[model samples]
Target: MGYESYQQLGVDVADGVATLTLRSGQKFNAVTWQMHHELGLIFDDLTRDPDVRVIVLTGAGDAFCAGADLNWLRNQLQDPPTPREAREAGRAIVLGILDCPKPVIARVNGDAIGLGASLALLSDIVIAVDTCKFADPHVRIGLVAGDGGALIWPLLIGYARAKEYLLTGNAVPAADAVRMGLVNHAVPAGELDATVQRYARQLADGATMAIQFTKTSTNIPLRQAVESVLEASLAYESMTLRSQDAQEGVASFLERRKPNFVGR
Candidate 1:
């Protein structure tokens, strides 16, 4: 299948805004390797697509992306990548969103957990429903919040707050998120699309190159931070993947019970 044959995503472009919807609602828009790779490539194509001036990422149904599919995670046991390989793949996904030339707005219609939280928070602007929640639960799954959480969280909320949330893997409500500087706006569920469209069109209609270049300029710090912190954090996360505790964590999750973690 071609790159256009993205199985896990749905795209609709109208009036210069491309709404990219995660279509796997049955799994709360969970990410698989394919979905993650598709996300990495979509940004590169959308950056060049003349019809698209802005991109808004959202999820179908009641929740935004919950996280990586547990089944997908379990399947990794069959053909696991090296720490470096996994980290590089992860880097691509995060950088694709950060480096996309078109303004990307996260329309967080509902729950944004784990990597979903990162995606929403990483966008140029995040517009979330009032009841939507954000959290990075990779740690709760016996992994570090290394993927994008460690990278983007501290940059938005302070290092102290980032550690508090990432370590505990607690859900932050939409209003609290906005108050803590984690998201740009929170509105009623009915107002989400309109609010996202209003801001997206404003960005699309503004001085195009100016807006794009401004995004480029402002992301310099973020780029530097990625180089400085992301790999090291991912390295630690990868180390934890090899632990017995990690296996138990997944098993407990699948068993629908509290994890009995004995630090190994």
Candidate 2:
């Protein structure tokens, strides 16, 4: 199948490794509405691409994705998605990653925050640069971490650890994330690309169907969690997106001041 021109994201294929790069780095590859929707669609195409034996996702610039675009967030604050739209969009992004038959690897180049953090963690394997940071700060923006953050973080770092970070919106350095079992490898910045290439080639050269089948089997629990939790979480998140607190968050972000969230 011919590839669609993924406007904000970039896709390149060589030696059976398809590198999907988030290219809007000037905006930290933040999730604009189009980029968010495209993200949901790309995985389905990648899953079927015979030329792509291994998939590596990373940002083009120093930062990975920075979550939702601030402009988009401001618009969302004023005109939030309808419950149905929110549920469907959020579910598509989450399920797109979970349902992909291929083993996707996240080459975490730098900061992976909010939904970006979810995207990174959804991968079959994750390799982070030692200086990269990981965080899900939705709550800080008066949004719920319902973008698969609730589904995966607890599964990776346990409920207590996940809550400690989720509730506080703290950033975890790459080394700390590795110690906490959140990422597979944390190598120096100089080694990031080579390490990802080596692993991608190794996987590309190995048992293809076996690895794919293994991914499917391992994702059963993930699929189940999505089935049970995603819709509700996204629904709640949509509701909150219209809340007074969410509006305040947008205002505070624009004003570059702390939000006075009164739990409205």
Candidate 3:
């Protein structure tokens, strides 16, 4: 109801297209704890907004979403959320996206790392700039890829490839992502905006009931996956959050050095 009150997300609706943008451009639209909670709530509001026939998720600047805010990660080391809190928050975001009836298009303008990568893969259609990359680097930070990465990656790219990327945290180029079936298209930087706009308009103008119904049907497996897998994943991630390796990982990232994980 109060879209204007959102501090980290920029909400703009025009001609049935609601574009929800991650507004922290200076930090490559990296997500903060506040932004993460908002992401789980905004989709439901957009879905309820009668004028919003299609939803477009994008970043304000060049980067789509870099990942979680390192400051937030550091804070987690000191004041970790309980497992229940972690599980619920993670479920809210993933379930929110899967539950939304409107077609969601991800406008990946730049690199999508960790949670960023999961967000992109969750969308119904993902279009990225050719220069951008996608990766779930939670493992690199000594954490599990629990926040939708493990589930969605395998769904989009299959088990072997998903395992490889998730395990290695390698950044997959946009072209390779498209070829691997991780995203729908990869266009030149100049074409990204226009391309996404075109798709949005098409979906906005298409058969509403049919499209919404189709999206709901398409997400059945995703919803089931959320039910079956998300709880355990988030729980494990929470466990890792309390580990010395996770602390070292955040410290190394902040120090701009390779993490020396002792696997504690």
Whole-model alpha-carbon lDDT for candidate 1? 0.86
lDDT of 2 by residue, 161-217 (tens): 999998888999999999999999999999998999888989999999998899899
* Candidate 2 TM-score, true structure as reference: 0.97
Q: Per-residue alpha-carbon lDDT of model 3 for 93-186, expressed as tens digits?
A: 8888889999999999889998998888999999999999999999988999999998899988899999999999998999999999999999
Ranking by lDDT: 3, 2, 1
Indicate which candidate wins on lDDT: 3
- Regions of candidate 2 where Cα sits further than 4 Å from its true position: none
TM-score of each: 0.96, 0.97, 0.98
Residue 133 deviation, candidate 2, in Å? Answer: 0.7
State the C-alpha lDDT per candidate. 0.86, 0.88, 0.91
Runs off by more than 4 Å, candidate 3 = none
